[model samples]
Target chain A: MQGTQQPTPQPTAYPATDRTVPTRSADRASYDKEIVHAILDEACVCHLGFVRDGAPVVLPTLFGRVGERLYVHGSTGSRPLRMTGQADPGLPVCLTVTHVDALILARSGFHHSMNYRSVVVHGTAYDVTDPQEKFLALDALVDQVVAGRSKDSRPANKKELAATAVIRLDLDAVSAKIRTGGVNDEPEDLDLPHWAGVVPLRKGYETPVADPLLAPGTELPDYLRAL
Target chain B: MQGTQQPTPQPTAYPATDRTVPTRSADRASYDKEIVHAILDEACVCHLGFVRDGAPVVLPTLFGRVGERLYVHGSTGSRPLRMTGQADPGLPVCLTVTHVDALILARSGFHHSMNYRSVVVHGTAYDVTDPQEKFLALDALVDQVVAGRSKDSRPANKKELAATAVIRLDLDAVSAKIRTGGVNDEPEDLDLPHWAGVVPLRKGYETPVADPLLAPGTELPDYLRAL
Candidate 1:
C-alpha cells in the first residue's frame, strides 16, 4: 500500500549527487548499476537501519536482490516486518553493504586509510503478501548467498513459508562510493621515517568440511567446488 | 543540551531487543567494554545510520574509538554532521561494525552460513566542542589502527581540526552478537549428498611500504614493523 505521495522530490539530507566530490580521483566515482550490483552481490552481510517511534534502529541481516528490488527475510514475527504492514505509514529503511579490500598503512598515521567499496540504498519497504512473489523472493535470497545452490536445495514447504516474512524495497535511490589504491600521504611526509603503503587484505574460503553425519559417497557440488 | 526527558521510554515500532534472540551459545553474547572496544578497533569501517527528513539514511565511514566513546570524523560540511546540530530531536544514530570470520559451506545449501562478529550501538550523537577532548579523541582514533603510531605522525593542526567535524557517541546502549562454527542442518538432512563445514576467513596486514618521498636514512618504526 502506498502512502501519501509527494508532489516534488524532497532533497535528502545527504544527497549523493550533491555531496559527492571527486577530489583525488574522478574514476572511482561510479553510479553504474553493474558496479553497484557486483559489489552488493559479493557482500554476505548487510546492515539495515530504520526509525521506529522516532528512535533509530540498526540490525545486521541477510539480504538478496532480484533485478532492481532487494528482498530481506526474517521470522514472520519480526517487529520490522510487522511494522511494514501497519496501516498508518510504510517504514522507511536504509540498507548498506561494504567490502573491505585492504588497509593502507601509510608512512604517517595521519594518512592511514582503507580501500573499500560500499553501497547504500534508501527507500521504504513494504511486506510482500503475494505468495508467488514471496516464494520467488525467498529463492532469490538463498541464491544470493551461494549462486545456483538454491536450485540444488529443497524448496521451503508451505509451513516454512508461512512462518517467514519477506519485505521488498526497490533500488530506486542507490549510490556506491569507493576508495582504493595505496595511502595518499602529504608531499612532505615522503621524507618521514615511517613505513608507508597498503597492506592488502582479502577474504578467502578455506577447504570445506563435510558434515559429521553426511552420508558416504556424496561428493561436493560443482558450484561450491568453484568457490 | 538534554532535550525533553520523557517520563517513560516509548515502545519502538521495531524494538531491537524484542527480535534480538541470543544464540544457544550465550557465552558469545557480550556487553563487556573490552570486548566491544577490541571488535570496534579491529574493524576498519562502520555503518552509521540516522534519520533525515523523516527517513532513514545509512552511510559507511571510517571510525575509531577511545575509552567508552566512539569518534567519527567527516568534512564539516557533511549533512549528517550538520543535522546533529540542527535536528530538533538531535540525531539518533546507530553505529555498527562487523567482521566476517569464515564462510560455512554446508552440505545443504539451506544450512550454509557465515561466521561473524558484529556490534551495534544505538544512541543520540553530539558534536564534540571541547578542543582538548577532541584532540585526545582523535589520537585515540589514530592509535586504534596502529597502537604506537599516533605519536610518530603529525597531529592534525588547528586548521585541519577546524575543517573537520567530529561526533562522539557513548558506548552505553550497546550489544554484540556473534555466530560461529558449522551449519545447523536438520537431522533428516544429515544423509543428504553435500559437504558441510566452515571455511575460515582471515584478515592480515601486508608488509608496509615506505612512502615514495620518504627522507633518506629514515628507518621503519617498530610499530609498523610489528604489523
Candidate 2:
C-alpha cells in the first residue's frame, strides 16, 4: 500500500536560468521539461559536480529519477553523501546526464562536433530523512534501473536503510541541450573531398549473466528478459 | 613538421595520489595508465568540470586524446577556453569520462549497483597556442572521432584555426575505476524470488547518414563504412 500515493504532475516546459543557457551553441539549448526528463531517465550514469574547498570535483555516479526529483545514493561514508546528510542547508550540486548519439565528423577538424542529448540540473541537494519519502525514493531508484524492479526485490530493511544515504534534488532549474541529425559544415567546406556524416551510436542490452550462486531452476524474470 | 617529432612513451602505470583513491570502495580503483587511456579513448564525450565564479560547472563536450595529453576544443570566445588561455597558469579542471556497461540487479535494494568503467583526471589545462601544435591537436580531435579523418578532410584555414581554441591536459594524475561481473548479493538474500543478474550494455554504430547537401557522386568512405 506504500509508495502508491499521488503522482507528481509534469510540466511541459521549464524556465531558462542563467546557468542553463549554452554559451557556445545557444540554438541547441532547450527548456522543455519532458526533454530534460527523458534524457535523465535514459542515462544510467550522471556526473555530479560539487565544489569542495573552492575547487570543482565531478564524480560519476548512478542516479534515478522519480517524478520531478532525482535520487542518488551512496555509502554513508562517501564524502558528498556525508556532506549532504550532516551539513546544514544541504550542498549545492549540478548534476548532468549525457547520451552521445553520434559522432559528427565534419569536413574540417575545427568543425567536428557531437550529436548528443544532455540534461543539466542545478539545485541544492538535501538528504532524504523522512522514512516514508526515503523508502519511496529507494523504490524509485530500483525501478529506474529496471522498471518494476522494486516490487520484485526485497525492500530495504531498517539497518540497511540507515547505512545508505540518498540525496534529493528537485528539477527546478533544468535544461536539455540536444543536437540531432546531420553535420553543420561551413558553406565553403561542403565540397571538400572528405566524408562528412553522422555515425549514429545505439545502446543495446546483451544476454544476461546470472549470478553463479543463483538457486537452480530460478527463471529470468520478464523484466530483465525485455531488457 | 612541428607536432610530428617525438611520440610520447607510453607509461606502464600511473602513480596513485590521495585524490584518486576511493574511500568507500577502494578495491575498485586502479592507477593503471592503460585502463585510464582505454576508457578515455573509447568515450566520445567527456564532462569537463571547472569553477566559474567559485561555483562548480560541468559541461559535456567532445574530446580527443593524444599519447599522454587530452585535447578539448571550443570556440575562442567560450568561457573555459578563454579562461585557460588568459589565466595566470591555467584553469584547474577535473575531466571525467564514463561508460555504463550494465545494470546489476540484486536480490536486495541496497545491493543494486552498476557495472561501469570510468576515468577521472585532475590537472591544469593550458591553451595550445603554437600554430603547429594547435593544428595537430585539431587533427587529433578529428581523428579521435573517426580514424584517418584528419588526412581525408581538408586542413583548417588560418581563419578557422584562429577561431578555435584547444586545451591540453597531461595525463599525470589519472585513475580508472572499473566494476565488472554479476551481482554481489548477500549470502542471506540468495534465495529471494527476485532475479539476480547483469544486463550488459553494448554500444554500436549504425549506418552513417550522409549529408543532404552532399554533392552528387560522393561515395561513403571506407573509414566510416568499416564502423
Candidate that scores best on lDDT: 2
How accurate locally, in lDDT, is each candidate?
0.74, 0.85
Query: What lDDT score is found at residue B192 in candidate 1?
Result: 65
- Residues B28-138, candidate 2: write the lDDT tens digits: 998987778789878768899988876678889878898999999999988789888744599888899988989898999888899899998888899998899888888
**Candidate 1: stretches off by over 4 Å:** A1-28, A86-89, A107-110, B1-28, B86-90, B105-110
Clashing pairs in 1: A107-A196, A190-B213, A190-B214, A191-B214, A191-B215, A196-B209, B107-B194, B107-B195, B107-B196
lDDT of 2: 0.85
Which candidate tops DockQ? 2
Which residue pairs show collisions in model 2? Answer: none
Candidate 1 lDDT over A1-227, as tens digits, reads: 27686578643333346324333334666667888888889976788988878877777778888988999888777667768873636778989888877777665555667788988887889888899998888788778877886776666777778878889988867777789876788777676666566666646665666666667887778877888
Chain A vs. true chain A, TM-score per candidate? 0.86, 0.92
- Among all windows of 10 consecutive residues in model 2 chain A, the one with the lowest summed lDDT is A79-88
Q: After aligning candidate 1 to the native by TM-score, how far in Å is the CA of B17 from where it should be?
A: 6.9
Q: For each candidate, report what fraction of the true interface contacts it reproduces.
A: 0.60, 0.80
